[model samples]
Target: MQPKLPIQCPSCESSLSVTQLSCSNCSTSVSGNYTLPLLLQITEEEQNFILQFFLTSGSLKEMATQMGNSYPTVRNKLDDIINKINQLKTK
Candidate 1:
C-alpha cells in the first residue's frame, strides 16, 4: 500500500511544507517551498469525514444513521472539523 502524505513534522509536530512534486509518467520533477492546501493540512480522518459528508448529500441524519452515532454526536464531529479547517485557513 502507498503511504499517506504527512502534513506535520514528526519531531516538533509543526505543519509541514511540500517541497517536491514529480510527474510519474515523464520523470519530471519540481521542487520548491509550498504550503499544503487547507483541507490537506487537516488529518486524514477529517478529510474522510468531509468526503463522507458530501457522499451523504450533506445530511447529518443520514450520516448519523450510517455511522451508528446520534445526530448530535455526528453534528459535533462535523463542527469540530469545520473549526479546525477555519483555523488552518487563518495560518
Candidate 2:
C-alpha cells in the first residue's frame, strides 16, 4: 500500500518526516511523509483548548462551562486561534 504523507509543522509549515506513525485505533505504525497546516504548531494549552473545543463538538457554551470561563472569553480564544490560522494561510 502507498504510504501516507508526513504531517507538517503548524508554525513553520515544515513537513514532518516521521520515523514511525501509528494509528490510535490499532496502534500500528503507518510511517510516511505528511503535510499539515502550520496552525497546529501551538502550545500545549492551546492544543488542549482546541482539542476540547472539537471534542465538545464546537459548542462554545459547553467549552465555557468546562473551562470555567465566560462565553466571551472562550470566543476570544477561539477567534485568536482562527486568526492565527488565517495568517498562516496567507503566508
lDDT of 1 at 12: 100
Instruction: Tell me the tens digit of each residue's lDDT in model 1 across 1-91.
Output: 9999998899999989999999999999999999998888888888898999999999999999999999999999999998988887887
Measured by TM-score, the strongest candidate is 1
lDDT of candidates 1 onward, in order: 0.93, 0.75
lDDT of 2 by residue, 11-91 (tens): 897646445568899887876654444644555567788899989999999999998999999999999988877776776
Off by over 4 Å in 1: none
**Candidate 1 weakest lDDT stretch, 10 residues:** 82-91
Measured on C-alpha atoms, candidate 1 has an lDDT of 0.93
Error in Å for residue 21 of model 1: 0.9
List the candidates' TM-scores in order: 0.94, 0.57
Model 2: ten consecutive residues of lowest lDDT? 34-43
